[model samples]
Target chain A: MPKTLTKKRMIINIIISLVVLLIVINICTVTGTRSISLSNVLKGPGLEPGDNIDYEIFSVRISRVLLGVFVGAALACSGAVLQAILKNPLADPYILGISSGAGLGAVIAMLLPGISLSFLGGLPIAAFAFTGAIITVSLVWSIGYFTGRSQVTSLLLAGVVINAFFSAVIMLMTLIVKTEQLRSTMYWLMGNIPEKQESFLLLSCGTFVILGIIILWRISNNLNIITLGEYESKGLGIDTEKTKIVAFSFAAFITAIAVSLSGLIGFVGLIVPHAIRLIFGPDHRQLIPLSAIYGGIFLVISDTIARTAFGQEQLPVGVITAVIGGPFFLILLARYTRKVSLMK
Target chain B: MNIIEVENLGFDYGQKTILQKVCININKGTFLGIIGPNGAGKTTLLNLLCGLLKPKTGSIQIDSKSIESYHVKELARKIAVVRQEFVPVFDFSVTEIVSMARTPYLGSFAFPTESDRQIIVESLELTDTAQFADRLLGSLSGGERQRVFIARALAQNTPILLLDEPTSFLDMKHQVGIYDLLKNAQFRQYKTIIAVTHDINLAAQYCDEILLLFPDQNYKFGSPKEVLVQEQISKVFGVEVMKGEISEKIFFIPKGNYIKNNK
Candidate 1:
C-alpha cells in the first residue's frame, strides 16, 4: 500500500500488458488460414504485400491484426469511460443501442439490393451503420434530458428501450426478407473482422482509436473524480455537466467508429474493461490504456482461434469473443470479489 | 471584509421557490452555522453560494466578484465543500481521495507536485485520517469515511470551507470529533467556515453566528444567543424544547411533543 509500491506495480503491469500484446499479434499472424512465418511477417518494408504467396497471406493477416487493434482499443476505452460517466459498471457502447442500431443499417444494406452498388459501393453499410449509431445515441441522450435532470438512470433506461426497439426492427426485416441474400449481414451482425485489406478503413479507425485514447487519457483524473459521484466531483472544482457531455460524446464517437469497422463485437467492450479493472485498480489513467492493450490482445487471440479452430470454415469472431470471454469474465469476477473481500 | 455577500438573493427549482429575498453578508474568518427544520432551504442556499446553483434573482459576490463570473476551478480554489452524504462505490484509497483536493490548482492533466503531496499529508493528519490513507473508501466505517471526505476538503486549502450537514448521521463521538477538527481548522488556519446543521445544540456550542430558516421564505440571521429562541423554535419546527446552560454553553432538549399529541 506504500505510494512507491503502487506506482511501481502500475509500471510493471503496463510493461507486461504491452509485451503480451506484441506476442499475441505475432502468434495471430502465424496461426491464420495461410500460415506465414514470423520472419516474413516481422521483416521490414523490403517485401511488397502483393508480390508473393507468403507476402499476400501475411499482408492479409497483418491487416486483420491492425483492424483488431483499432477496433478493440476503441471499444474497450469507450466502455471504461461510459462506465465512469454513467456510474454503471455494466455500461458499455452497446448500452446506447449502437450495436443493434448499426445492425439494422447493415441488414438493410444486405437485404435491399442495388443500394450497395451506389457510390458507396460496399462501404454503404459502414456509412449507414455510423449514422444509425449516432442517431440512436443522440435520441437516447435527448430522451434522458427530456424526462428529468439528465439523470444517468433515465439515460440507461432510454438506451434499453431503444436497443429493444432496434432489435425488433431487425427481426421484422429478417422475417419479411430472405436470409439467403443476407449472409454477409448475418455474419457481420454476429461480428467478423473485415475480409479484405481495408487499409482506408483501418487508417480512419486507427486515427479515431489513437486520438480517442489521448483525449480520454488527459481527462483520466476527471474520470476518477466523477466516479466519486457528480456532486462530489463538482465540489472538487470539476464542471461535472460539461465533463459528462464531452466524455459521453467522445465515447460514443469512438464506439460508432468501432462498430462501423467491425460489426457488433460485444465482449471486448464489456469484459476487457472489467478484466483490466480487476488486475489493475479502477483509476481511469490505468484502466483506459491497459484496457486498450488487453482488449487488442484479447481480440487478436479470439480472431486467431476463430480462423484456425474450425480449419476450413471460419467462425464469426464475435461468437468466438463471447464464447471465450463470457466464461473467462465470470471466473475473473468470482476470484476478484473473493480477493476484494479477503483484503478487508 | 465580507468573504461572501448576498443581496436579496432568491432561488427556485422549476416553478417551486426554495429561498426568496434572502440577504446576508459573511465576514472573513467567521464560523457561521446554518440551522433549520426539514425543508428549510439551508442546503439549497449553501449550494447557491458554492456556485452549484444559480440564483433566480439578485446577486452573490465572493471576494468582491460576482459568483457567476468565476470559473468552477476558480471558485473551488476559494471555497472547498464537504458533502453530507457519502456513498462508497469505488475502492479508491484514502490518499487518492485526499489528494484530489489539489485538483483545482493542477492543470487538467497534471499530477500532484511535491508541495501538493505535503499539503495532502498535512490535511489527512489534521483530519486524523492519515492512518487510513492506504485503506480503500469502501473498507472504512461511516465515521471513518466521513473523516476521509473532510480531509479531502482540507486538502483544497481554500480560504472558505462549506459543509452541508457534515455531522448529521454520525454518532456523538464522531460528530464532536469532526466539529473539533473543523474548529481547529478554522481557528488555527484562520479559515472562514459555514456549516448547514440541523442539530440546534451543536450550532449553539460551535458557531459564532447562526442563520435560522423556515420552510417559508422567512429567515433569521444573528448570533446564536439572539437567533435561537423558544418562540422561533416552536413556530418553525412545531415542537417544544427546553433550553439549558452549562459551562457557559447552551443546549436544547426536546419535550417529547409526539407523546403529548398521542395522549
Candidate 2:
C-alpha cells in the first residue's frame, strides 16, 4: 500500500476497531451460557434495581471479557515491540521460549505437592512464569552475545535451542504427572481462561496495563529509528543496545503476565501486530494502540467461540485461536516471503 | 576554531588493525572528503567521529571538548551521521522516518511539536524528497532511498554531518545530486560536512580538502591540488597515470599497462 493511503486507512481502521471491539465484547457478554440482555451488559454487572441480568452479567461475563482484553492487548503489543526490535516479522513473545519455559514451571508446580499452597498456588504459578520468561530472554541474549556480534540471527538461534530444551522438560514433567494433574496441566498448556477471583484479574490487568502503556510510550522513539535498522538507529543517536534490552524486558514481562493469568495462548501476539502494521504503515505511535485494541477484540471473539461453540464442552481457547490463527499466519508468511523475495 | 579534532586515532578489531595513527582536524563549515580503497578504515573513521565506536588509543574532541564528555543526546544534537545503507525492518513513511531525527530533542514521552514538523518538511524539501514525503521508504528506489536518508540526517539540524559512503549505491546522476546536496549543506547551511567516498574524482570536484589514504602506512591530507597528484595517484593506487589536469582543479585517468605497450 502507498504510505499516505495506509495512514488514512489506519485512522479509519482504528475507529472501526474500537467499534468492533465494543460490539464483540457486548456480544460475548450477552450470548454466553446464561443469555443476558445487551442493555444490562452495557449498564455493567453492578447493582441495578429491577434488572434481571445481574448475576450472569456482573459476576461471570464481565471478568471473562476483561481478562480476554487485557491478555490479548498485552500479548499483541509485546509481539509488535519484539518484532520491531529483532527486525524480524516472525518474532513473537513465544520465540524467546518464554511460553515453554513458563509451561515447564507450571508443570513442575502442578507435580510437586507442597508447592501448591493455598495462598501461594496461583501466585507461585505467576511468579514461576515470570521468572522463566526473564531467565529465557537473558539466557538467549547472553548466548547470542557470547557466540558472535549479537546479531538477530544468533539471538533467534539461541531462542530455538532454549525453546526445544524447555519443551523437553515440559514433556518429561507431563509424563510423570498423575491422571488428574495431567488433565489440568494439559488444559493449562492448551490455555484456558480460568474462573479467578475478580480481584486477582483486576490487579493483574492493572499492573500489566500500566507497565504496557509506559513501555509502549517509551519505546516509540526507539521503534521509529529501529525500523530503519540498528546501524542507522545508532547513527541517529539511539542507544540501540539499551533500547533493545528495555524493549525485550518489557515484552517478556507482558508475555509472562498474560501466561500467568491464563496459560499459553498463541497467535494474538503474532497476527495482530502484522495486521496493524499492514494498515498503519509501521509507526508505533499508531501501531501500538491499534494492536492493543484489536488484539483484545480478536482474542475475545476467539474465547467466546471456545466457550459457546460446543455448548459447554468448553474447548480450550488456545485451540480455538490456533484453529483460526494458523491459516491467517500462513497467509501472512506467504505475503512477507513474497515481499522479501521481491526485495532481493 | 576546528569543529572536529582527532588526535592520534588508532583502532583495531582484535589483532587486525583497521586505522593506525590517524590524526586530522576539520574546521567548521568545511567540506572534507576522506577517499580510500575498500577496508582502508574510511567508514571506521566516520564511525569514530560520530561516536558510534570508541577509539582504542586516541581522543576525539568536538569544539575543544572531549567527545566522551557529551551525552548521547547532546552529541546527537551536535553531530548527525548518514550511513551507506539503511534497510528498515518495517514500512515507515518518509515523513515519519525523517521526524525521528528529532528524537534527541524530545523527552521520553513527548511528541513532535509543530516547529519540529516544519523542520522535517524543510529537510525533505532540501533533499528533494518533499514530493515523496508520504511515500513508504521501502517502496522507493535505491537512489531515492539514499536521498531520503540524507533528508533524515539533515532533519537532525546538527552542526556536523558525517556521511559514510553516501554515494556508494547511487548512479552518476544521483551521485551528483548527493554531492550538490552536501555542498549546499556546507556552504548555505554552514554545516561541517565530512564524507567518506571511493570516488576520488567526485571528491576532487566538490570537496574543499581531500584526505588520501594509501596502503603504504601513510596518508596525504591537503587541498585537492596537493593530494590528487600524478605521482601520489600512481603510487597509492598502483596505476600509471596517462594524463591529468590541475588547472584550478584536479582530474586523472589511469594509464593501463604503459610499460607493456612500450615493450
Candidate 3:
C-alpha cells in the first residue's frame, strides 16, 4: 500500500466515525414521545410556547440520554484499556467485581435506617456505589500485585473471588432487608436513570470525560506494546508493571464513576469495544476514541428506545440494552468461536 | 571500546537456577552470536543484558554506564531488542508496528514526525517489507512476520540491536535472507548486533564472535575459528563433528551425516 493511500484511508475512517456519531445522535434525539419532527428537533425543542414539552425534552429526556452517553462511553473506553493491558478480549468494565461490590454497598446503605441522616435525602446510592467500587478494585489490585505474577490470569482470578464475596453480601442483604427497601434495591440493580438535575449529570459526566481522556491519551503507547505480551513489551522499553498499574487504576476509576451514575448498566462496555474492533481493527489509538463515540451513540439510542417505546412507563435502560446487546454479543461469540475452530 | 559488558552475572527463579556466573563483553559494531542447546541460558543472558531481568549478583554496563542507572527510554534510544514468542492481540498495520520503534524519541502525546515516517519506510524497505506496509501483522506469514519485527528494530535505528532466536521458526530461505540482511546492516550501517540462536552453522557463517554455552557450567567465547572446533563442539553439545572446515569459509559436518557425505 502506498503511503498516500494509507493516509487517505485513515482520514476516511475519521470522517466516517464522525458521520456515524452524528446520525446516531440525531436518531436518538428525534425519536421520543410526543413525536417531535426532525426539523423541530434540530431547530430546538423550545420553539413551542404552552406545551411544557421543552421541559420534558431538555430536562428529563436529554439529561437522561446524555447521562447514558457519558456512562456508556466511560465504560467502553475503560473496557478497551483493560482489554489492551490485560491482552484479553473477554475483559470488561465490571470484570473486577465492581458492580457486585457497589450493589452490596448500596444495599447496606439502604438497610441502615439511621444512615439517612448522612445522605440527607433517602440515600446517596451513587456515593455508596462509588465507595464500594473503589474498595473492591483497590483490594483486587493489591492481591494481584502481591502475587508477584503480574499476569492477566492472577488479576482475573482475584477479581472472581472478590466478585463472589461481594455478591454473597448483596444476596444476604436482599434476604434481610424490608420490602420497601428491597423494592428500591431491586430497582437500582435493574439500572434505571432517574430524573436527575442537569447540573448533577453534567458534573458527573464532565469528571468522567476528563479522566477518560487523560487515561486514553496517557497509556496509548503502553496499550500498543501491551498487546504484544508483557515480556515482549518490557523488551520494547515499556515498564510493564507500571503500565499495568496505571491502566488498571484508570479503568477501575472510570468503571466506578460509570457504575455510580447508572447503577450497573450491563454489557455496553463488553459489547461496544468488541464491535468496534470488528469494524475498525484493534489499534487503541483508533480503537479508544472510536469506542467512546460508538458507545455513547449506542447507549443514547438504546435509552431513547427504552424511554419512548412505551407511552407512560419507561423501560429500565438495562433491560433495553440487554435485549439489544445480548443477541449482538451472542452473534459475536459464535463468530469468534467458529473462526477459532476453523483455525484449529 | 566495549559497548556492553556483563560481569559475574547470575540469576535464579526461587530454587531453579537459570544462569550462573556469566561474563561477556560486546564491542561497538561487532556481531556476537550466543549459541547453546536448549536450556543453556542463551535467551536468559540476552534478557539480562537487555535489562529485562536483574542479575542475582554482579552488574551490566552499556557504554560504561551501569544499565540500572539508565532510564528505560534512555536505554531504548541506544539499544533495541526483538524477542521470540511475541504475540500481538491487536491487528496493527506493519507500518504502525515499525513506527513504534520511534517511541523512545517521542513525547507523551506526540505523533510520529516526518523523519520518523521516513525512517520507518526505509527500515521496511531494508527488510523487504515495504510492499506490506499496510498489511495487518496478524495476516502475515511467520517469515514475513519475522522480517517485520526486524524492520521494527531497524526503524529504531539505534547503535545496538539484540535478537532472541530470530530465525527459529523461519524457513531456510528466509533464515539465509535474514542473515544476509543483518550482515549487510552490521558492516554497512555499523550496528552492533547480538543474536541468540541454536544454529551453530548460521552463527559461524555470519557472526564475528560466538559465545558457546554448555549445560555443565562451561562456556567458550571467541571467534568462530576458536569456538566452532571439533573438541569444543563435542564438549558443549556432546556430539562429535567428523569433519569441519575453517579456512576461507567455516562449515561443519556432523558424524554419520549421509547428506554431507553425498555433498
On lDDT, the candidate that comes out on top is: 1
TM-score of chain B of 3: 0.93
* Each prediction's DockQ against the real complex: 0.55, 0.37, 0.37
TM-score of chain A of each: 0.92, 0.85, 0.85
TM of chain B vs. native, candidate 2: 0.94
> What is the alpha-carbon lDDT of model 2 when measured against the actual structure?
0.80
Misplaced by over 4 Å in model 1 are A1-15, A39-51, A114-122, B258-263
Task: Choose 2 or 3, whichever is better by TM-score.
Answer: 2
Docking class of 1: medium
lDDT of 2 at B60: 95
Q: Model 1, A250: alpha-carbon shift in Å?
A: 1.6
lDDT per residue as tens, model 3, B1-263: 89999888888878878777778888899999999878888888888888878888889999999998988878888888887634477767788788778778887533577888788888999999998787777777888989999999998888999999999998899999999999989988899999999888899899999998888647889998888887778667767675456665577656754545455
Ten-residue region with minimum lDDT total, candidate 2 chain A? A1-10
Model 1 chain A worst lDDT window (10 residues): A1-10
Write down the TM-score of every candidate: 0.94, 0.89, 0.88
Give lDDT for model 1.
0.84
Per-candidate clashes, comma-separated: 0, 1, 0
